[model samples]
Target: MSMTLTDDGQTFSAGRWPLSALSVASAVLIFAVMQGIVLSLTGGVFDYPLDDPYIHLALAEVIAQDQYGVNLGEAASPGSSALFPFLLVPFAGTEFHRYLPLIWSGVGLIFAAWLWGRLLVEAGYGRAEWRWLGLAAAVLGPIAVMMPMVAFVGMEHSLHAAATLALLLGLHRHFSDNGGVGLILAGAFFGAAFRIEGLAPGLIAACALFLTGSRRNGLATAAATLLPILMFMGFLVSQGLDPLPSSVQTKLSMTDPGDEPGFIQLRLAILLVNLREPGGMFVAVLALASFLMWRATPLKGTRWGVLVLVIGAAAAAHLLAGQIGWLNRYEHYILVMTAAGFLVLLPKATQGAVTPLAIGGVAALILGGALAYRLPMHFFELPPSARAIHTQQGQMARFVKDYLQTDVAVNDLGYVAWQNDNYVLDLWGLASAEAREIRTTAPVPGWTGDLTAKYDVPVALVYDHWFEDGIGADWVKVGEFQLTVPGGFLGGYVVSFYATSPDTVAMLTGALEAWIPTLLPHSRFVWAEGMEP
Candidate 1:
């Protein structure tokens, strides 16, 4: 089957099955290769590079039992996406739950690839070599978007990217064929549910619709996109917590109520950081060039111009408010959106004067350079990255679960909280509102200690340097977990273990002594001072 584009280049026949299959197969192959690398490094243990996914799983378990936070019956908004954990509720507490995110991500990849293929077809790339190039881009989407990386991260990012594509495709359909308003709303609601950042593209597309005089559709789109987020925030508020999820509030460093900078200044500061990133700069330049080319060409009329406005506005919004890179996960949807917009606009901008070969060559260079910049390096780094987490966080989980068997304090919360039934005090603020408030508003000497003492936390596994103001005078450095693994993604190579009081020092040291022999290869526990058991 082949896609057929109409004369107006606004619509295409339904024939994306082959492209969808190709994309799924290609993604599976890529994922299999990544898993092979991970298996080789960790002796066949499948684990995510970052421990954040486990946090979601932990929350899912709690939610399944009619709770919210990681600890049982504790109400806290730790998961960023208010919807992701609930989605995992059915699978929570099962061995299969761990793979659920990967499966959902796979489904998202297939749909995204299919939608992108349809968009490319509408853009007049449905035939011959152009079709093949479109298929390639459809399968991989965009190199800079790092779809594979996000899919493997076991998070909602892949689904978020897919929803963004759906919105973009819906916008194209609306402008060109005066249809697909349903698709836009579906994209908006699900997109926002997947990630709050997803609202930027949806809202931008809705505004474009409004400006293009589709007022009813625009209003529906705006409401549909924002409803889920508003509902989530309402849910958080009902729990006597902050309106936003703890994870979101913690990450938006600028919006802290205690922050000195005004909101606009902080936004500008975030924009500055975005521009400083090489990937961010490249995307910005591409968006600017695309906007210029669209204005210069005959395609700047109402229909096509809407696409330009939506894409440009979405990119600008992301650069101003969203994050750029955290293992190439955040801002992926914007990268994909920008790349798709550029591809659709390129031929129109050049009026077909540029040969397909030239265009493909330029795309090849850009994709190659982007892949070189992060993909290959991060791909190989995945295994070691997982290993590092296993060596450090995973080991910590084991010691806490098998030995401590009680509530403890830790700056990094994922693995430990997920593995144990004990209460986990997250000093990092992601799972603890109290901790977040103290860190942001009242960070001072012994602040960490005060929080831990309040929670009755006896031991803490944290990075000491992270607390320059001191963890607290009551907190005694008992030992440290040192990862000997080289070239992996981690906050630090060493995680310090501190007993909240001197009396607990002996207990911690004894636990460390008993657990040291079982430590993962290449990681060891170093005793502090004369505390060696």
Candidate 2:
């Protein structure tokens, strides 16, 4: 049960548990230190790196409460992940959730690292310092070895990354071991539970697994991957939810989606953005070198023609429908895809150096370890860069409940939607259907005013640039929240409060004038006076 990839001078023994333990310990230590910095700077670990995790947390709380959606009694799929929310049902309201993401992240990194370590050991790289390569790769290796960020995002991405690694290694080991199909199946099932896009990696593994064996193997692989997906979708539909979660559908441009900058264009744009980073530049050079030397060291597996085809499948699956660079989580999986490809293929290129191609694969790990090592090369990133969501949405949620006393509309649904019981009309459409319609149709300025009025939504917390035709001055801006940070996503962001009803406008305007001193100490209230509603 050995081959070109995992074959070598010495067959790996079964008593390598200590090294495995070290790998897990190292990954846990790195995560703890990194997160400790963020916690010290941010005040609390509950302030996740991204606001989206909160959306899932909110839904999980509802699910825990035996209800649905971010607002109880609403049967909407606000969370894009399948198993993640349900998994949180047990810890939804407890302080355990505050620490759960870090736990999940640590465990995921450790699991993935353990699997990769086994692959390396089987390949004869487990001797001396080489055994530590897998552990380091989990924390910092390649620009895509972004385990730290994934873990901090407080989402299911950590598990997704681990699953991807398991599938890649299982497929690689399948023909030789003849017993990896179970690993493949388990990886697919568990991965798909985390994200809808999880299907892509699992499907790719199935096809690769089939190619490595008989038709029956292929059929079994397909069944393992597809059956769970079908059952899950069926379950969602049975519950009166969409087959695909609302987040997935909206992101893929199905139900009033975001501005999709084409497929090829989006991929190219992501590549371009990467080219700007130092780690990105290094990765590009290494990939080019690997490509030039691929034929001399093709992976042990068969490709239709090119050695890069297996990697290409992953790229096609992701790029054709993947989201690119939204708060960093969107295209982050591409990192694992890229790193896994190199791990498998680079060993082939350096065949002369103790299978030098394999050594070359190990060398590639150095780039990420150097760049993203400590604090990461994303130097501009602050420990608590998420202050906006925690403060703005949090304060605004309370403001709505205490002052407005009615349903409101919003674009950023995470903070405001979760912190209060108020019904939120999500302009981004990830949460509310009516909001999605408005976003899809893209009302003409004044049209949104009419729409809001129609829905009896008197107040909206939004950015002015969102409405193209403008909601007309009559809607009236009562307050403006300033968001400023160096190179931050919300830099210069101003959340404006507008009211439709004249009476409500007056009340909100007066409320803002009175509260601006206390709530918005440094902020100002912008009044659109003399404008009639």
Candidate 3:
């Protein structure tokens, strides 16, 4: 189980594994299966913990019908992933779309482990045989801990994580071996399709290539990453939508722009908060990693020098563009990638200076603490999380599509938007550029009322407090859908039902009148107090 290295950090003879990649693969598979089982028992293969992934499916459904957005005809940029909607095109409206995202998580687990094997070997972490299996788990365990969580969340984050590792491997190979253009391009392409923020790791690698005088490779890297994003953005603009996604705009707007905190100060404060959060261990390890990367490579032409620069550049990017504490989902991929990237450098940094056991011990302790401190899931969180979306939003989508078949205003715009073939006037604006603009940029008088009036929304399913003053008076709460939903899954779990028009009142009332009786056994829907038609 011990790996003996020479002064230059290379082994004189290969061990039993000789880079078999078996141990890493097995570890990843084990975790994937554990997460898969949890997913199956909790809801099924077509289930997800969060509703955001459904937003992509909603867009995919729109694309499937030769249109855009949830309303079918209205074109809008809702999901943050650049090519995710297109990726879901084949199974957009099919039952398989929901299941495929989790599958991608498994693939990411395997592929990332494969890359990790190469990276460990390249960094002289030693051979990986049956004996070293435990060592592999100890060293690479952080990735294993997060992979299943990424999969269950059912976003493109799994792919994002894999793409990031690939880019790191490509950069090291490019510098040391004068190899890896193909790997670089593949990672960049993953960024283009996986998630818009996924571009950071690969784009940073491309810049490293250019900085290291590999201009041809650099150009290819840039083209691969930029082309798909440009195409997607242009398409959105052509359809008269914001180039930036609604998620991006909304998250940025969520950050307070108060005169006291000051914009820069608030972002700085948030940035510091993010580095420490999700887990305190990452910050400590990443700080150690910065020093390790610098020592590992020469400043003039080495990969670590490039890596240090790129990581610093990337941290700045995340500070400006990213947020944390949204159930540890938003910044998960990049954070893990940063930790993994530093691990790659550690072996080289400590080559003759320290023992391999020393490095392994450090990594295991830090990452293990992170896992122990913040368990991504507990059995208690699963049922309520699933029930919230499946029972409430899923039911709401069905009601809007089958029972009412009318445009409605809703704050939570994923499941209903995707499942129902109706236009949802997203009050929070994850699906509507105009709504986001009204909420953020425009100082319009009675903006919410203006939005409702402009859209002519017949029904409104939002939080009770969302519709204030004029807007609240205009709508009547005929019914409400309440469930013992968890707060961790959503910032605040509130899904209400309102009748925006008189006809909507009658339609909802009639449907509830008939359906409420059928739920004599048990159900979550009932008439709003004293406001039933």
Candidate 4:
């Protein structure tokens, strides 16, 4: 409760929980519950959403037992991105060690959310606007509901979010308190975030630096903190260990699907509609805040210059790094700061005036959180709808747990592998380059053939609905299962597969034909293998 950790010449204290900090405690509890539900459903599984989660858990487990690297069930090589787990290893002896990330994420989010409100109010959020700003900071944003909802133990995501918040806060403090300590501390956390996701955090920090007009100091601080890490990475490279993957280089080049500028733009635009529509009210508030900042205060010289730099850098970084279509929500942080600058420029005339802005902002955030929670439930499902995705996921997980035989091999199929203890030949292992090759390099005529021939994948869970473009047909659907309703799980079909073998064919085909009607009520199941005739 009263522990201290120093980084970059600054000390960070995990202070004792203050009796007055009940609000923060409550927030943490709420966040924990949300995360716990997902964890429970997934059975503490670490797969899919990229293999980073498994790597983190495996690393923590390895470090907990004081080993260099060991197989964590389904994981291979313990993978790269070890910093987050390394931090937790020291605390691993205690129960809190295992749940360290959960604690940090829950607490970090709450702290960030709380500080955002105070920062806004101090910068210029009127009493009326405080509630809305708080709501916005809590829900809408790049690292909002979705990331936290899925990533309870996901340190990288949470760390990135928390550090981004800290970086923003540090910039805010630099302008308001002329606080060098905050700047240095910001550099450390920001540096760690970059260690996890290099490009985005680095971009965010650069923005923060420009915003503070302390580019020289910010750069120096960042370089100093990151230098050690870089040197370590170089050492690894010398020893023939690529600290990270070429995927990073590809991501930096914006070639990765998610990082592509066009895709980011499209996504950002859609998300920004939250602010853009509804009468341009949020934008109006931002414009007004900027105007006020310019009008009243004698905030000139280093203070104003730093502010300009901070605002500019923050704004540019938002556009450059974040999804372009999500501007409405992604811009939440910048808006908060923009509001602060307005307040500093022209201290609110009356606390009473912000009532409408507060109402508007809060409403926007609630709507955002609601939407954020439900979108993935719907879109990423098999059928692309919420109606049956949850149950469908349950059914798939249950089926795998019950029937999967032989060590399984999959292409980017961590979610399934994580749920059960089958030896998974994960095509998407630590070596993402291999994964890229697997995906882009064509597969054999049937998924089973490809696995057996190329990957020596003995058994597979090939999806049945590739005609619908579900997960692709590089693998064939050897087995089939159906939800009670079509698209109930997601939309299309939730079929199972087994390798092309005499025993597998008979077992899976018979099991499915018998099990399908009983479980789903109005579903059909068939074995595509017999069609060979």
Write one digit per residue (lDDT tens) for candidate 1, span 1-533.
Answer: 66555545544443444554565566666766887788888888878888888888888888888778888766889888867888777767667887877787767766666666667666666545455555665566544456666677788888888888888878777766747788899989889999998888888888878877889988999998899999998988887878988888888764333457787887788888888886687668768867886777777774677788788988998888888877767877887788778777765665544565427634753574365346677677776787788778888998999988878998877888884788899998888888888887678899988888888889999988877775887899987889986866677899999899988888888788788888778898888888776
lDDT of each: 0.77, 0.59, 0.64, 0.43
**lDDT tens digits by residue: candidate 2, 1-533:** 22223433334433343444554555566556656766665466346556676677677778888776887666777777777777666677665665555566667776765665555444334444344454444333422465555565677877777776676666655644535766767777776776667677777666665675555766666676677668768877876877876676676554122365665676666556556555455444444544555655443333412325444565555555555454456544545655655665543344423454455455655555355333354433634455545555556766777766678877777666654676777666777665556656565557667667766777888877876564644576665766543333442367878876665777676656555555522334454555322
User: Model 4, 57-152: lDDT tens per residue?
Assistant: 545555565443322322233333435656656554343443555555565556544554444444443223343443344334323233333333
- Candidate order by decreasing TM-score: 1, 3, 2, 4
Clash count for each candidate, listed in order shown: 0, 8, 0, 25
Ten contiguous residues minimizing lDDT sum, candidate 4 = 378-387
Candidate ordering by lDDT (highest first): 1, 3, 2, 4
RMSD values for the candidates in order, in angstroms, are 2.6, 4.9, 4.1, 8.5
Query: What is the Å distance of residue 401 in model 2 from its true position?
Result: 4.2
Model 4's number of clashes is 25
lDDT of 3 by residue, 287-399 (tens): 45565557544433444677766765665666555775444556656665665556555545644334564356445645563564355454346434654556556666677
> Which ranges of candidate 3 are over 4 A from the true structure?
1-46, 128-134, 138-145, 259-267, 279-284, 292-303, 352-373, 376-384, 442-449, 466-470, 485-488, 517-523
Worst 10-residue stretch by lDDT in candidate 2? 1-10
